[model samples]
Target: MGSFLGFSALFYFLLAINMGNLMVSFSQEGLCSAPPILTSADSSDQPRYWKVTNPTLSPAHLQDLPGFTRSVYKRDHALISPESHMFGPLPYWTNTLGAYLITPAMGSHFVMYLAKMQENSKSGIPPRDVERFIFVVHGAVLLTDISGVTHSLNVDSYAYLPPNSTHSLNCDTSSTLIVIEKRYNYLESHIPDLIVSSTDKQPLVVTPGEGYEYRDLLSASLAHDFNIYIMDYKPGQFLNVKEVHYNQHGVLILEGQGIYRLGDSWYPVQAGDAIWMAPFVPQWYAALGTSRTRYLLYKDGNRNPL
Candidate 1:
């Protein structure tokens, strides 16, 4: 009886510890989105808060946990890169697609993954009430839509699936895809169908401000609630203005190196890095290395103010 009781106690103790850690993982709510600090002073340690309906859905693993709601995620250490099934049995994952979940930093409103697909493998996204965007990094993948139209996508290719759109992926070679899924927030009546071949298309050189140029992937005609772009900056170039707005952003550094000003602190960023900036946080970026800096950027827009 004594030995049995001891074992039970040990089990309960470990369970308690696990539960405590889980709570800590979400204790700060979502990736730190504290109010923007107007001054140029470094506010790296400012209190961060992210609002989410379900905190428990966020990643609780120690390494995946972002200390604040705002984070500068480096590929080497700041982010979590788990193999497929590392997050447990997802509904549609297979060995062919190794998905690294990265949206835990943004909270429950969306999910993001850097997925690697092997050759000759297939995956499906059944009809659902969510919007999805897949951006090809390297190699090619065949995408088949609900209407039976199929096409091949190579590097810099991107497809946007509207809510309830059915699609399946068939890869011809080993490839990397940035998969971004988010609940549809209805604001406009029309959503344009998009299958953008960014590599073949010429980028519009738009200067939203000075010292930077934006390569817009989707134009305003598409009626997407969010905007996506590849921001390009020459060496020694930067955004001269500090911006504070209601739109939240998800960014992936695609190439070169730079430093980003989030809130009041500037952090070094490089290719393969990702960042989540909550709404209203002051932000800016500057190119550093000799090569041009490029980043895939996402920002929520065209929605009614909450």
Candidate 2:
């Protein structure tokens, strides 16, 4: 009887040890499942979609513009004057999720923090004065227009809204959307033109391709603040010899890899990279590997004489 009791106790002890080891292994695996975050240094050093070949002209030229002068343009272009002037980081809000506002000091620009909607909530966003270009960064959303036009968008999908256009968004699943607002007056001498789909039924979808394909989201003559475009580049394709005539443009890489030539230098670019080019600079790019390259293009300043 004593031997049997001892044997039983040993068996229980071994079982408990095994269970503990299993728990520890499961915990470690769970921790590893989360995605990795990029460090600030890594982001700064990452390659961009456009390389600066010309040592003389680059997006850095905008820094040479006087702050006071830029401020004046900000006031003239934006509907709501920003509380601060220096353009580093903007204010943000948090509720169930995080949201950051990127309000530029000049050229009627503001990007809204991504928002989250409750399961039963009927509306995703409140009515606002500024026109918005909504880009889905994470998850999914169902956008419904006042006329009952419904759009289901996934990550990287976007929608353009004119001023006073009534709409609501619904997130059956969790989502994060970036809303870029144009603050310039449409009645002004230079009203930024909104790029509309040639077909009213569907939003123009930019798929993976070889050559760069762009549809103007907004024109310079229409809005003095900025011009927006949706551009796509297919695998092994590129923009070989193109010159940006007017306005400093910024490229936000949304997908894939490519090599950008800004003058004499070649730079490798991947997803999430951003490159800014000054006016009159000649530049081009080639898609890398088997992946197609895609990006959002923005140009700010006055119309250039072509």
Candidate 3:
């Protein structure tokens, strides 16, 4: 009887610890959004949260455990390498959810996250007051809009969600997504309509000077307070100039390799690397290697500089 009671006590103790961790973890959420994993299976810390939505859902380790998990390193706002990203509790989401997150806390006016979702994963149906932009990097995602309209998005597809709109996302296959969110001046702009489109379908514009090629995923007019760009570079091309401007940017390297000059230093960057720049930080990029380099970039647009 004594031995049995001891075993029972141990079981309850561990269960209590796990439950406590779960409550604290769900308070925040996504990846430290894709640093190479530093810890191996044998040496990993015991998972603090377990995926347990229902009997039908398979289990996975919830990696972002509140304070226990965060960006792999202290992020340098002027420039963040691919290795440093914010990891937090992603509550109300399920099934192999992983994202490298960039939030306002990191000193940007906007939030961006690269979400890696498995089949059966979804973004919870909640009406966030902020506007949202989602770019599909791979796989398929179904977006349920504020008006209950459902849109299907495939590779290179994107969606712009207006402020105060209720929506949710469902992925039927393995997928990767970049979700950018921010507050908008509805009073000034009158809330832009939701836009659903594909990047590949947009006309590519060659910029002045060095002829950098890109497609504006959003309009350049006041109707949009921000813009998303998929800029492409050939192996030997470079940015037209060292851009120093009022507009800040969050950039995710989509393909190939390049050297990025941010602030006063240059960092070698490649696919899956995420970089965030604050207003007035000098920045430039030059593609390297034998292939083209592409990146998804976000910049605040059309708003008064005040």
- Cα lDDT of candidate 3 equals 0.72
lDDT of 2 by residue, 1-306 (tens): 999999999999999999897788777766334333333533445333221100111223343555412111122221111221222222232222433323343332454443544353334343455666766656667778767788877765677676666777777655555555655445545433333232123345443533566666544354445556667777877765566565555565666767776655566665544454545556777888675677766665453344
TM-score to true structure, per model: 0.68, 0.48, 0.72
Q: How many clashing residue pairs appear in each of the predictions shown?
A: 4, 8, 10
- Of the two candidates 1 and 3, the one with more favorable TM-score, higher being better, is 3
Please give the lDDT score for candidate 1: 0.65
* Span of 10 residues, lowest total lDDT, candidate 1: 48-57
Q: What are the lDDT figures for the candidates, one per model?
A: 0.65, 0.52, 0.72
lDDT of 3 by residue, 69-139 (tens): 21232344444443345444355766645454567787788878767677788885333567889887777
Model 3 misplaced stretches (Cα beyond 4 Å):
1-89, 125-127
Cα RMSD of all models vs. native, in order, equals 15.4, 14.3, 14.5
lDDT of 2 at 161: 70
Give the TM-score comparing model 1 with the true structure, all chains together.
Answer: 0.68
RMSD of 2: 14.3
Residue 156 of model 3 has an lDDT of 81
